[model samples]
Target: MNAAEPGQPADHVVLRRAGATDARPAADVWLRSFAAALPTVVSPRSADEVRGYFRDVVVPFRETWVADAGYRDGIVGVMVLADDELSQLYLAPGWRGRGLGDRFVGLAKERSPQGLTLWTFQVNKPAHRFYERHGFVAVEYTDGSGNEEREPDVRYVWRP
Candidate 1:
């Protein structure tokens, strides 16, 4: 398959296993991507709080994969997987719609060959469409309670 979809820019990205040193920059990508993609989700925490969450909790506790821009140390995207759940997938503002997400999802499927699950805010229609197009089916919907954003959400599952 082509690395980039039609109309998307061709970017040389390195999808690699993240190390402890990546936690801070990966968190920056997470925070920026969240602000760019889900502003309407209304997170209860500040950007700094989310940054700390990524550094201290998400990066340390979950298995993280980072999409690095070729020739630079910049982290353009991050995917966090905990067990079979895809806990986080975020791309920098400039990296959106550039096939980095496809790469991340491909890596996720490779890592969890059995199947994978994820949650996206119901208000994030773009995310819903993206996940659906990637063969994920919405298996459940929940009220705005289980997540920090307190936004209504949907759970999607992809199975082989």
Candidate 2:
């Protein structure tokens, strides 16, 4: 960040492990992001279901991280890693385009240095572009049968 500019990623965004208390805030980011980024896709889970997943499953069982954007932004983004799979990456709607997503992807690659794989709805062109810009390549495409959303999806792989 430029010295002149304040409150950007380098200044305020801190990526840290998601704690039990972070479950709801992180889930809120995911929910808002999903709605904003994939408006056409249907989410199989309700809001409560998602919060429970974050509390009972993601934070407890997976390598979940939250991008705490200081006091002003609070929990601005969430990323979940299931082994080598970048299972989830979502930034708050207002927080998009500020490099938080890029930071999360960088952190994911650093955590899984050998490689990482992720899935995104085929219609989420922004996600496709973002991941591709981060060195992930499209490896496969599925016809919406295997996922809960029944939405066409693409898989991306990144190898160091």
Candidate 3:
């Protein structure tokens, strides 16, 4: 049911500003996507914990966007930005590799014209490659300490 399936090209998908109603669905996408992709990098929070975190803390606090999946009941993905940093970006399991991420970054660049920075766990090689392909460069690496997950991470920067 992913909107990215063959006939559904991503270019036509609209990225919209997320609202209060989107909090839970967006969080669900985040949790499911994280569960599918990041198990090797960090221990995931329980589903209830993730739902609470995103619904209460993230969606309400961050400037967030969600890609409309046309006919689908929920969003195709979610992006949350904090100032000049790309705090989070998660696509539904079937939505990856559909160019929606590049589109998301283009939007992020528009929102933060100065530059953008993000942190991703070092073990997430696909994420590292994706950001690099989109012009992000690794600027720093940290041992598992500062982040809640306490997983080693790398900081990436993108300059206009």
Q: Write the per-residue lDDT of candidate 2 for residues 92-151, one digit (tens) a residue.
A: 877788888889898999999999999999999999999999999999999989999999
TM-score to native of every candidate shown: 0.89, 0.93, 0.91
RMSD (Å) per prediction: 4.0, 3.6, 1.8
User: Relative to the true structure, how large is the alpha-carbon lDDT of every model?
Assistant: 0.84, 0.89, 0.87
* lDDT digits (tens) for residues 131-157 of candidate 1: 999999999999978887788999999
Candidate 2 displacement at residue 89 in angstroms: 0.2
Model 2 stretches astray by more than 4 angstroms: 1-10
Task: Find the number of clashing residue pairs for candidate 3.
Answer: 0
What is the Å distance of residue 19 in model 2 from its true position?
A: 0.4
Q: Model 3, range 5-56, lDDT digits (tens) per residue?
A: 5645677678998888888888888887888898765555777888888788
Task: Return the top candidate by lDDT.
Answer: 2
Clashing pairs in 1: none
Ranking according to lDDT, highest score first: 2, 3, 1
Arranged by TM-score with the best first, the candidates are 2, 3, 1
